[model samples]
Target: MRYLLYALTLLLSSSLLFFVQPMVAKMVTPVLGGSPAVWNTCMVFFQALLLGGYVYAHASTRWLGTRRQSLVHLAVMIVGVLFLPIGFEPPTDATSLENPALWLLGALFLGVGWPFFVISTSAPLLQKWFSTTDHPDAADPYHLYAASNVGSFFGLVAYPFLIEPRIGVQAQTTLWMICYVVLIAAVAGCALALWRSAEPEAAASEASPPAAVLPLSWGRRGRWVLWAFIPSSMMLAVTSFVTTDIAPVPMLWIPPLAIYLLSFVLVFARVEWFRSLPVFTLFPLTLLGLGAMLFVQLGSPLEWVAGIHFLGLLIISLVFHGLMAADRPATRHLTEFFCWMSVGGALGGVFNALLAPLIFDRLLDYPALLVIAALAFPPALYSRRAVQITLLIGAALAGYLVGRDVMIYLGLERSRELATLAAVALSLGIPTVIAFTRARVLTPALLSVPLLISTFYLGQPEGNELHAERSFFAANQVVKTPDGGYHKLYNGTTLHGVQAQDDEFRLVPLSYYYLTGPLGQLFEVLSKRPERHPFAVVGLGTGAIAAYTHRGQEADFFEIDQAIARIARDPRYFTYLEDCPGECEVILGDGRLQLAQMPDERYELIVLDAYSSTAIPVHLLTLEAVEMYLKKLTPDGILAFHISNRHLDLQPPLTRIAGELGLVVRGRDHWVDANDPVYNLYVDGSDWVMMAKNEEAFGAIIDHPSWHEYKPEPRLRVWTDDYANIFDAYILDF
Candidate 1:
């Protein structure tokens, strides 16, 4: 009965400990882009604190002994409860946003530090406590630690599915407060158990189990670091590939993180069934075979391709974590072992979040990290002749296909069909041989050969093509097409530029939207006032806005994507340069940053057609950002915000910004007619919000039904770069 109380205490303590992780993380999600980096950074801080807690636990067992340990831990619990309600208090200044990691770490330390430290150390400390108690055959505390993680896994899984969807963020905060109080009271009960079951130590047996020992030497720690680092880094790399290369969706962070956490379940679970030899024996074969497949880029039909890669990474991470878990020591050394592992995890977070973006112009870290992880986790079966033979053949075939694809991409051959077929065959053939032979060592090398080749092929055209293609925040592939003697530039998912194919198309902006809507109407009006008609475009989708410029107007294009600018201005991609002469200049960097950098400038018409809910960078809609836009515009400048969003009703925010800026606003929705040929005469609709400095400008565009008096809702808050509350904005019904 006493041991069950200890067991229940450990379970409840751990449940409270891990439940706060996802709850606090979800609270911070709206402030940060819902990127995996948010979770990774949180893990770094959690692990760092965890290491501290473990060291304290290990030392208490060695020096202070069990009785004193209980007093100290219970005292820390009492102190920790003072900072209750699991949520961060916003920092006092804006500079804190510059390095949110340090701020978050400090905040986490203050808010839950004592409680977490108390609870974290308890896994080991209580186990030692259980061993000393008069209860015969105290089950291994190591198994309870596993039980702790099982509770943790439940917490992680529950947040997104059950808790987050049903409970409001505030409700989550309130619930955590109630849980913490109950958990603390439960711990107090355990402290009573320790005091009541007291024994004058079988003094010989109670003297701390000879200071827990480490199995590995310094050299072995290096190997553990390597083992830990590769899988940790690969987790981030897989997310990059899935999110960027496959599908650039907002909620894409969930799958990769879930996969990464599942590794812990495999590694730490108390169940030993399927936890041993088969994993190690088959590990080499699957590593090389799957590793190679992951590296290869089979283009298009990608709806499920990303899923396949995610699943492959899941298998790899699970395999590695299982191997590590199998080798882990008894309860006494568990904390120390995890402490060293934490170092590797922290390094992985830094490399992916901070270093990779600045170091590589492209997502180079994805394939590179995969290759590294493969090498770090090499299987023990590399000495077989049969495996060696299969690997060599796979490598040779991949080499030939890669060579052929490179030649075609380089214009060495114009036959796209032959090269395409050859590339497909190579991608399939190599994986089959590696799978058949079970050669793990050859898997990484084989996979890497194709991936490296694909990267070069993709990079070569991107590097060399100036006019139609560029990669900045996302890959912008622009293709030129001729329509009725007009030249048009198409961005990956949308058409960006439309002009005459020859000098004829140059003066005529040709798309359905550009030729008929408020933008098209604004162009017609600007033709009469060139000297005073400077126009600023927020996004440089295809440099198409430049095509709308007339003889005397000066235009500056505010483009956030470097890749889009490179391809949009390239003569090969479009005739933006050849057709629209000195009327335009491209300013590269984030639109908000560049505008903030600019001198007091006024545009006759400023386009706020930034993305909204879809791929809309939310930073542009913040009160702070809109204020910057108002500063850069003329007194009568028409602020046209593209409010055409599927999920977000941005008109409210735009209206709020207009009210704050003391301007009047109107909205217009434009579209194309299926049978219109004159194009200019096509009926148009747009949810364009036009804000101005006076009543007359606001009244001028108010007749449209979409137009409404600007009103800000009490619950409808504006988002800023430093913070955004997307949980409030989640349209679950929609």
Candidate 2:
């Protein structure tokens, strides 16, 4: 009966802890914008929460009696019941996006705070209870932890592949609530067993062993932390690097996290047979070395390697971690070991996710973590002093040769000078070894190779011309597609804008919905406007806005990317710069930042069509963003937003912004037949949002040749960088 209760408790705790991650994380994307940053940040928060709960359980056993501990947990559980079925309060107004941290905090408080707190504390609390009740027969509580993480792994994978696909968010929430109730009942059963156990106090005291003791010092504890931290943090940094550089898809966060959890499972499993030895031995050597090697080739094929490489690092890191766990001290020291490990984790998150971006332009965290890992794990010592010196010297020479050759291949140093530097580097290793064996000379020398490599990579700034540039988080590249049309590529998302005209290859606007239906009507009205039309194009994609330029007409553009700006404004790439020459001025920076810089500026038409596919620039739709547009536009400026998407509904967010700004917004859903002459040369199927300051502008659009009636859904809240929610808007089927 006790065993059954333990099994039930394990089932309940595992389900609660593991499943909430993906479910709540997906729910928060729309609120925080669907950037990979959100998911990474959520991981940091969850790990911190788990750490806190573990500390709480430790405190519970030390200060409170078992009966009192159960009563206290029961009361907390009751309080947590108030957060049943996991849901957050809907934002009340458009400004909600302005403060996303606050928004995230609120959602966490209401939706899962108490419940997560309870579940997090359960594994440790229950383990302590078992040790006390069963005395000598009680197994190590630490082994159960292996089961706990296994549960977490299942929960993480199950959500995206199963629960989310099978049920909508509402139904998923209901199922979670049912699971929570069952867990509470199981906990009550455990408490009943504790009360009814007939073991005499004296026998229990005599039979139960004293709390497990640590055989290590503070310094050793610190080493354990370094092991745990370097890998976990490196995994996260690699996740950011891969997603930011290779693909910005929503699911990209999964593999890195899954591999991270699986590492824990392999290291902690009761039996060693399940862990693969080859992976433990060979994969680490290759990954640690190759990961650093690839750091030298950022824009080449190395840029395209996905989470699989990250998975390799994870498995290798776990092999070391498993080796460490096998040698872990007594259970009494587990909390101390973990506390320091938590410190390393928190530092890693802060360093990689928060500090790295602010300090450097491109991703530097991954390389830094690699060097740290190498230092943390020095090569095995040789049996004899002379032999040790020889082995060290040989390793040094090989590393130098490999490092220099790799650097030359990556275009860091001139090829002609490679042989000279190679000779110099190799020659120094022998003398360096003699100098190092006599003292600590090799410490700084060994560290310099990676440091120099890191410095070289970081120094090679990504170009911001039409072809190349790197932003705070995303890498931008330009290419001529097979159709002979230019495209702007940000990560994996393609932005199709202007196509070269068939005859002379003149620039033509091929923006998704520009040639048909309601969008055509707006174009006609804007074309016929008496005044010279001034326009603001928020997202500069392949300089497509230049297609609308007319002789003797004045125009200006607002592009957030310096790279995109160069593409649109450079006369050689797009004719708009040549034809309209001096008619427009390009601004650079975040769209909102530049928009605020030009409060007195106005435009007759505004196109907010700049999207890098998988990522939606959330700041562009905030209430503040809407007001900026309203203030910057001529009263008659027609705002056209390209809203084509496979995963999200942007209209509601736009409508909410429009309503807040007192502007009327309409949408044009357009489809084109290539067989039709005028439409054939344009967008095949497009969706565009058309907004006007008031009824007069709306009337003008309606009177245009292609005007069509547009009705927008009311009450949709405006999205801001701080508070956008895409869970409801996600188009899962597509």
Candidate 3:
């Protein structure tokens, strides 16, 4: 019963820690763009807080003694109750908008900072407290660490699959507050148990454990930090690659985090056989396979790529965490071990989330860390000279193929891409096989391959790149089309919008925003209708939609990224905004926030083109958001959403929301052939959905061949700010 009290406290506290992350992110969705940076910033804040908690635990246990520390912790817990039911209030200043990550960090701190700090202290502090108790399992309190992660894993998995689909974000916060109060009582119970059950000998052994221990050195501490750092960085990197680069599956970040927590669960659970597993052998081989896939597209299904990378992350995390777990110090140093681990974890977040964007033009941190992690595999595998000779011969053959491709790079863009693929294949495949055969002999060679490859681009993306910049929001690029006939804007790999470079076609909308596209078709209908106030565009992508506005008319483009706004206004990259026949202004803020302030402007048309790089701005798609948009529109105004995506079927949930709002929705799955007689249109396929109060609101476009009444499947549910299921909307294109 006494041990159960300790476990229960760990469970509730860790659950609160993990649950509040997504709940706060959901609250954050409206205030920020759908940037991966937002998630990482939140992680950095939580990780920093965790380190602070560990510091408090280590200091208090040394100064106040175990029994007295518990009394002090109880006081801290009671004071934390003042910050309940976390809420967000976004900043309105123009300067704060430039670097949203800084603003987001401050806002999250104010909302959940105190309660989270209290929760963070529980894991290590309780484990330390448990180690001094008379309970039989108290000697190895690491098992409680597993229990804490179980709570973490459960909370993370539960938010999307169970809590989010069923309850709203607002209610989730209230429930979280209630659970937090219960946790305080559980923690109080543990304190009473510790004070009552601690023996005289246990008190004397406070400074040292029963077992003999070596002196803790700086080198030993550094190793612990490195071990913890790899997994922390790998988890975020894998998430970015899988969702943005490989494929954007909704709720995809869960598996990597789940695996991360599970690594702790396996190691700290003290599963004896796990220690003997051949993780070092599996780590390099998995890296080899994933590196091949990363450099060369095999035309494999999305599931295949996702599966291999996920497997690599699992093996790599186990190897890193396993090393630190094996060297865990005596029970007396329990809190100290965790404190160092938190420091490493916090550093990893800072590197990937904050520093990497400032330092690199591309997401190069992932591959660079992989090479660093490979160096940690203990060199237990070796082979004879004969095996080494044979592997070297195989590597020579692969090099020959890579050279042949490189020789053809002067031919065309396709040839250059093929050459790059060959080089990567040689780098990843040959070294991987050679290392696995004689790991120690080729380990240095293996490390050099990825470092060289990741540091320089071999022209893999296949375009005449004109401009590139990395921001906390995302990596933005402006590149000329292969034909050199058009300029394109890209956020990561996803093309945001495009414009023809020719002076004759400069004002004409191209790509998905072309005259024949769904957005243009909606505009065609709007052009004939009585005009309302200037239309509002949620996403400002090269200002392509500005072409639709007539002379003397006005249009407002709400752009969240200041960098993107700058690009659209710059004549060198794109001239859509400059060529606008109407009065145009780019408002620098999140679309919803900017629109909320414009209560008097009754826009006749509102276009939601905010989705970039498959990062769905789910806050904009919910029932509450739709209601807000409707309120901002004229009596018969139209709400248009650019639903064009390669990985997600976004229309289903919107159809469900239409039913909930009792609004009429029409859609068009429009595609323009590149080889059309009017090829200069430079258009591509697009999907758009527009909703109105009734049939009369749409005018003549409703009866057009491209427009249809789109409906949702029976299982699809209306998305509100409180509840959304990306899984239901995820397209099984793989």
| Candidate 3 local Cα displacement, residue 378, angstroms | 4.1
Candidate RMSDs in Å, in order, are: 7.9, 9.9, 3.5
Residue 367, candidate 1: C-alpha displacement in angstroms? 2.1
Q: Please give, for residues 579-650, the per-residue lDDT of candidate 2 as tens digits.
A: 542365565544555655664546777778754454666556667677777777887777788777644567
Indicate the worst ten consecutive residues by lDDT in candidate 2: 378-387
Error of 2 at 461 (Å): 1.1
lDDT of 2 at 368: 68
User: Alpha-carbon error at 88 in model 1, in Å?
Assistant: 5.0
Q: Report residue 385 deviation for candidate 3 (angstroms).
A: 11
Tens-digit lDDT track for model 1 on 63-92? 876777778877777777777665666554
By TM-score, who's the top model here?
Answer: 3
Query: Better model by lDDT, 2 or 3?
Result: 3
Question: Which pairs clash inside model 3?
Answer: 168-722, 169-722
Off by over 4 Å in 1: 1-39, 86-139, 194-215, 280-303, 381-734
Q: How many residue pairs clash in each candidate?
A: 22, 6, 2
Better of 1 and 3 by lDDT: 3
Q: What is the C-alpha lDDT of each candidate?
A: 0.59, 0.60, 0.78
